[model samples]
Target: MLRFLEVFAKGSQIHVPVGSPLIRKIPIFVDEHDVTAGAMKLIKVLRPAWDTSDVKTKLFTDGTTNKLVGCYVEDSPEDVVLVRVYGHKTELIVDRDNELKSFQVLHANGCAPRLYCTFLNGICYEFMQGDALGTQDVRDPSLRRLIAGEMARIHAIHAHNGCIPKPNLWIKMRRYFSLVATEFTDQASNVRIQQEVPSKAVLEQEMAWMKEHLSTLGSPVVLCHNDLLCKNIIHNEKDGHVRFIDYEYSSYNYQAFDIGNHFNEFAGMAELDYGLYPSREMQMDWLRVYLQAYKLFSQKGEEVSARELETLYVQVNKFALASHFFWGFWALIQAKYSTIDFDFLGYAVLRFNRYFETKPAAMALQIPQ
Candidate 1:
């Protein structure tokens, strides 16, 4: 049996050993509170040959979930390495081991960035060049097609061992529900949860209703970046391609759920306006491109038909409700455990409120006979 020891190595004295008890040493160091210092330390180990003194860092403040810092030398700005510090107690919400495996799989398939290494509470990886897509940018006709094509390629990635893909939606939602707290240590937080959030029993009823209704949607199971918010999508104007990042929520899931979740994100996060949610006409256009690209990538030779587009249109709209419901539970759990300063309880309320408000219309969508 091997044990982990936290022996901090100083200067250039570093050791990477295999199966030797006496020489076992912690490979990387981490400081969650002081991410800049931690990022520099990580860069030293990641690029041992580079002059550590010449390294420059930029902290990306747009991310609400994790601390992201880009470290690079001045001469080679494009070769930046991103250091990601996991949010407080995020382990309760994310499966780190699974996330690593998913990253490797997507990287191998050319769908994601190269993962450098994993430390105590974070990861180092290659930084891609691009601007994160804005709300209006996604609505642009040409960019929308590019986004759809990229998503189709991602969904077409082969499953491990050629085994059938299984949906992670219900399983993850159930897990998140289990983690949602009934009370908080802080009086204000506890009071807020009690007054704003639904009761555990009510949430359970909604979950059951979703499973009963959505299970039979006929949506295929595919690898998905379950959380495909606007910021998660990076567009490179030089190459005219878009790449999805943040694998913390990536998994095999219902296809419509992935697309529908992305549509929900059209409302934006900082200040949500569901009025911005894509119209039925807009979704039809997006789904057409996605279907054609999915067929081409998956090697399905059939021509995409109107019926096919209609089918997915109905399925995606219905699954949009699941997206709202899934994230509602996730926010509740974050409210209880996350150290991030965001109003997680308020986010949860918004999600659940949207879920309730849209349920009537979303469930009303039906496939043509």
Candidate 2:
């Protein structure tokens, strides 16, 4: 129980005992007016505690300005509600509305936590009293199938509604890539990054070429959880089902990119364990099962042909290039402004190296021109 008190554990952040009576007085540190209002409303729904009851707000600090408040009421001490105060880093502009809506949609489908309310800069949602999936959990054959099935289910969801704008992945990448000149720092790292990875001019050319070819790929474009890092998959130990959190990167994109990014995740979790990266055969095996699940979920699509499957296999391998490049630039931008202790520049180099590493494999495939 004490071990779960920390935000991230060694391999995984396991479930914590939330409802137990071994209560302690944690500080009710809150500043944002919207957060307070959101928390009070959640409290009201939990019980009639405004009249007379002890209320406590527990804080979860992760070194970022974003405020995470756990609202606990006297009547329902066990039922904890988390208030996510959206403190947007000026450098990173995520659509708060899109993120909230994505969360709600996934929650409705039982793919994410139950969202409660949205305010000025944040939203309150159900906190999963569970553990994060470990590196092995993601690599195991059976578990990988289960996760693939879950991703298939997510992709089946319609991204844009009547007025909601669909995500423009090309524009998004262009926007991220635009920051390279201004964001990348550390002359030594810049020199190393330049020598090891594609130069900005080369990347722009590659991106243009990739975009032209990928748009014509046979696979259907569906809602993609673009970032499938291992840390984001939450496993409910009680039932063996996993729910994905962090909707900031979820958007409408090519199915291949989503699957490729996930396969890319198999390369490593916290650190680069390229040795753990899946073999081509293993990736294809998972893709087949994923397609089966996708077939079941997508009612309108015709049965996948062997040729379609082969195309997808090749396309996924190629899209792997885009995934690495996407994150490589992302790491460079994050390295510029992020306050976290992790070495963003070094991580940027790693992602860039992965981009180069995957390029040859993509070249070998007879993908769409």
Question: What are the per-residue Cα lDDT tens digits for candidate 2 across 338-362?
Answer: 5545666676678777777778777
Candidate 1 lDDT, tens digit per residue, 1-369? 122121111111111122322211226666667898988887777788779899999988777678889999988889999999998888877877668767777777788898888888888888988999878888989989999999999898874444465677887898888777445324434777778777777888999998998989899988888888998999999998999999898877889999999999999887888999999899999999999999999999648998999999999999999999888888887877777778888998999999989999988889866
Model 2 off-target regions past 4 Å?
Answer: 1-78, 87-93, 161-167, 184-198, 300-306, 367-369
Off by over 4 Å in 1: 1-26, 184-189
Cα lDDT, model 1, residue 19? 32
The Cα error of candidate 2 at residue 289, in Å, is 1.5
TM-score: which candidate is best?
1
TM-score for predicted model 1 compared with the true structure: 0.90
lDDT of each: 0.82, 0.67
Residue pairs with clashing backbones, model 2: 19-78
* Candidate 1: pairs in clash: none
